[model samples]
Target: MSNYPINPSTIAAPHSQSPLGANISSASLTTEQEFETGIRIIRDAYRKKIATKDAEIDALYKDLRRRDAEIQ
Candidate 1:
């Protein structure tokens, strides 16, 4: 509300947008970049692991078919 003074110190911070006070500090930007890099690394590792699992599944299916044919 316009009647409330924007208090930055209070732990009960209101999620209100202020044109004058909404400035990102250098430290905050650095921290955000680091977070993004960490997220990217984790995502890439997960994707590689999934691809490896898919390849293993394909190999297993092929082997199963070969064994089935030998039994027939």
Candidate 2:
């Protein structure tokens, strides 16, 4: 499970108008983009981890079956 919150409530509100409104908007956009990238990276990592675990489980099961066959 991801520790990162994907909830909308956790997202920061885009900056409101100010003297640096343009700069703030640009920065906010960058931050949001980075956040999305981070999520993708984390998600991919988890997928790889799951795949590796699944492969390990399958190998173990195969080994168990082989052992059973030998016993018979």
Candidate 3:
């Protein structure tokens, strides 16, 4: 054969589809808007979740102190 390399066809599958891929149509404006909105919503949710968790931890600490006083 000429000065060329032979690669297996099965080994050359595509790594990834184009940036947006077939899942998102190029003309879908609502998808883009929702994506941005989703990012903001998730961020807000995370903040609220953290605040709730902190409140629970504080309550647990108070309960522990009350129980410790009973043990003394």
Output the worst ten-in-a-row residue range by lDDT, candidate 3: 14-23
> C-alpha displacement of 7 in model 1, angstroms?
32
Tens digits of per-residue lDDT, candidate 1, 1-72, equal 599887867754354433322343433344456566567778999999999999999999999999999999
Which window of 10 residues has the lowest lDDT sum in candidate 2?
Answer: 16-25
Clashing residue pairs in candidate 2 are none
TM-score of each: 0.56, 0.58, 0.49
Minimum summed lDDT over a 10-residue window in model 1 is located at 19-28
Best by TM-score: 2
Better of 1 and 3 by lDDT: 3
Q: Could you tell me how far off, in angstroms, the CA of residue 68 lies in candidate 1 after the best superposition?
A: 0.8
Best by lDDT: 2
Q: How many residue pairs clash in each candidate?
A: 0, 0, 0
In model 2, what lDDT does residue 66 have?
Answer: 100
Off by over 4 Å in 2: 1-29
So what's the TM-score on candidate 3?
0.49
- Residues 1-72 of candidate 2: C-alpha lDDT, one tens digit per residue: 999779987776666433333434454455556566667778999999999999999999999999999999
Computed on alpha carbons, the lDDT of every model, listed in order, comes to: 0.69, 0.72, 0.70
Order by lDDT, highest first:
2, 3, 1
